[model samples]
Target: MPNPSSTSSPYPLPEEIRNLLADVETFVADTLRGENLSKKAKEKRESLIKKIKDVKSIYLQDFQDKGDTEDGEEYDDPFAGPPDTVSLASERYDKDDEAHSEGNQFPPIAAQDLPFVLKAGYLEKRRKDHSFLGFEWQKRWCALSKTVFYYYGSDKDKQQKGEFSIDGYNVRMNNTLRKDGKKDCCFEISAPDKRIYQFTAASPKDAEEWVQQLNFVLQDMGSDVIPEDDDERGELYDDVDHPLPTSSPPASSQPIDDEIYEELPEEEEDNVPAQVEEQRKMNQD
Candidate 1:
């Protein structure tokens, strides 16, 4: 039998193919945040990651819709009535004590603790840092529950990295670029306490979809407000030409030493521009 905790498609996949997919998914999830890879490697990695996510999303939706395994076998519920009780006389006398003990041990679910996902996917969130990167935008597996926004390092991560209540928060498209570099397709969530959480989507359409979903939930919760216009987003909303430096440091920024230039291998030196352009296009995509 397949592990119940593992994600499985409603349509049966060959064991070899399924294992290969799982390995690729694990590799992509584990290496996505690493910055040590070459530009070409990074581009390929991101592309593979996107494909994996798309496949996972499709399979998950199908699994939910089908609501059964391909084998068509019915699985027994473990929560069904017990086959037998320990003792009828002991149970009669201890039922009240057991109930009281359970009540004290487990509290009722809170009103704000809705754990079902309304929307979920990958998104990059800006976080402060004191390192050379200055500020970093890191990708996370994000989910929006009823009144909470939760994030994890990966979709398969059991423990959440963090979460916040969005009861009175407002979400809007705010495409402001940071001091480090430009980030397009961005949005901001303004908390009731004046804290702002920023996130960048893979595309403008995606960013708008996230904003719309959040707006719908907020409106239902009595936050009646409209998303801000593009002009209000930021000064850099339309400025897409200039982006962060990629591949390697520009020649002007390099040390003015002839020996450094002479030491560069001919093959590596010639491919820098092409590599940079490839990375640029990947980022734009």
Candidate 2:
């Protein structure tokens, strides 16, 4: 083991840690050469190797720079060396912090930036009720976050009524009957859990936009678990029952005849029965 007393840097990585890092590098390299690796897997391994090399380079540079310092004297460092040297070293040599200190090429991510709103609006959610109607559409304020769909009683409501993950859910435009028996512009989020959430948008366009955004999010999440084709969807996601089609078919499309019926002409007094006429004459007399 190299003498710690000979090292000028106050926080130098231990020999065991250096050996472990080396072993990690070797393992990562071997794994990278393996066949049948996905593109994402290969990219991640390459990134790991780059990070290891960069960390090793930093320690070598630090040692060389502080070599001329007084023998057996520790250099001043901002961090107090903790017993867990690996944690301390990681903190002291954090590349992200280093980049920020030297002037970041990219600006720091803001809280809003981390989870930008995917979609937000007022939607009527079908909730169960004990009223004459088994279910009713209650308007809800909704927004899509990185991991889940959040819904509140109103836009300003801090307390969310409910939320569900988008992992294995599928979104599609589905029309359903309103209380007045008219179909509403709606969509549904169905999952393998057999729990279907239905929402009514203000308009067909709004419903379509919601579906598109949610579908895009599911696809981006890399959850190919939900199949795209409607025919194949039943095997993966719960099939929601849509009461109506997007639009009602025109009456002209029906098989009924186009012929118009003419009205029959009324008979004159000559058509009256003789017994009925005689009875009416005697009553009048």
Candidate 3:
């Protein structure tokens, strides 16, 4: 370490260097005064200011070269160093290639490809109000049904001429009907091309099987009847239970009555003035 008293100048820095030092000091002071500075940033700024001051002090002192040598050559600076340009370029190139490859890849399949459908067996049970599987079973059925619909129903030939039908007997309680008589449940089938087919089934499973067989026959005949939208197909099953709306009823023009006015007597000009004058007098008093 060099002795501080050995220096001729009382100040560590010369006049010009002192001015530069003063500017740096003022800048550091103002930055430290900033309220928004984070603790880490304040510490970093303080460290940097100290380093700058140390470098300035060394430059101002003009101390004789210590001539610290490494194999007869002066020591080279470590901090003021050049980066490895070649390595940086290689990394950048790799990132660009990865981005290009990702951009060219195919898009993922849409979630709408999966549709809901009731299992044929489940539908049979539901029709008769029989004990059936729970919600998890229904969900599993939907997944399997979607797979089957996509695999068999989506075929162009099957979709064009295939048909779906359901049949199950439902008992109706009517005040006018005889207690012993049961209503017949008719089977109705609609082909993709708007053709209708009818059949009778003793049970729900039988009805579903009949429809499946019909679908197979249509596929064998090169008829197409697959649904275009999976979501739309799911909606079809839901809407089957609900009655469709007919045309809306026409609007009616009706006059509304004024209840407050109805209680008042027929207006007379003198009576109105007297009432108003009496109310005004009461308020003033």
Candidate 4:
């Protein structure tokens, strides 16, 4: 590694730049030393003043050393060093193109061309009971696609800690049952097994749009159905559970890209209560 003392001065130091820097430095210094500062101020003024002075030191040294450049162009910028860009020889690029053209008859198709593939990507979702420390409604990045849903602690995380199927589910806008301020932009998803998942978007429109888009995907897959547990959901879900389609997609893959959101196989992890089990048994009559 090169020594920091050997660094070249950054440039384009014209008369205008010098005057502007001087004005800024003077203004900052005056503001720092002013006696008429607000009495209600709670910030550490000393720390801010030191930070400004440190930045000014870097700029001042750079300007003084660069004051003598003949050309108007910037020279020896600290932010930009030697240009690493290089162009391949024309003959090499031409030969590579020729080889590439001799390979395939048809160009590869992209996955987004499939039918009913409305929208799919990672989105911020907040669980109802995720009150970490003292903050309410902690957000998690969730991956949503036509058939699968995944959530992780962060974007670059190695493995997802929790996930659920998007198929055979119902979605609806959040209702203010828990009395948690304005929940107009919150929504809930209820799986076939009666497990409810809640998410809040940045706005009511965003939440509604997500619910509508999810409902559309479910309809296409044949899992669109109205939910039948309004009272049960009111007791458990803080938001609301809207009716959804009751269809399931086919087993075959579609034209859409497989790399988008990897589909999760249907999981059967329902732990229905004894009352619900008895009700189902009675419904069979």
Best by TM-score: 1
Stretches > 4 Å off in candidate 4:
1-136, 177-182, 223-285
User: How many pairs of residues in model 3 come into backbone collision?
Assistant: 12
Residue range with the least summed lDDT across 10 consecutive positions in model 2: 70-79
- RMSD (CA, Å), candidate 1 to true, equals 31.7
Model 3 global lDDT (CA atoms, 0 to 1): 0.34
Error of 3 at 35 (Å): 2.8
Deviation (Å) of 212 in candidate 4: 1.1
lDDT of 4: 0.46
What would the TM-score be for candidate 4 when compared with the true structure?
0.34
Query: Quick one: ranking by lDDT, best first?
Result: 1, 2, 4, 3
TM-score of each: 0.38, 0.36, 0.16, 0.34
As for TM-score, the candidate ahead, 2 or 3, is: 2
List residue ranges in candidate 2 displaced over 4 A: 1-114, 177-184, 223-285
Per-residue accuracy of model 1 over 41-151 as CA lDDT, tens digit each = 888987876665545444554433333322231211111222111111112222233343222222323223437878888887655321121123455678897777776
By TM-score, is 2 or 4 better?
A: 2
Q: What's the lDDT of the predicted structure labeled candidate 1?
A: 0.56
**lDDT (Cα atoms) of all candidates against the true structure:** 0.56, 0.56, 0.34, 0.46
Candidate 3, residues 1-285: lDDT per residue as tens digits?
243334244444353544344344434543244346788988987786666545544443332221211112211111232211111222223224334332222222222333454333211011111111111000001112322321111122122111122222112212221111111322344434432323334444555564555454444345356534668888888899786978664444222235445545555554898999999999999
Q: TM-score of the candidate numbered 1?
A: 0.38
- Which ranges of candidate 1 are over 4 A from the true structure? 1-114, 178-182, 223-285
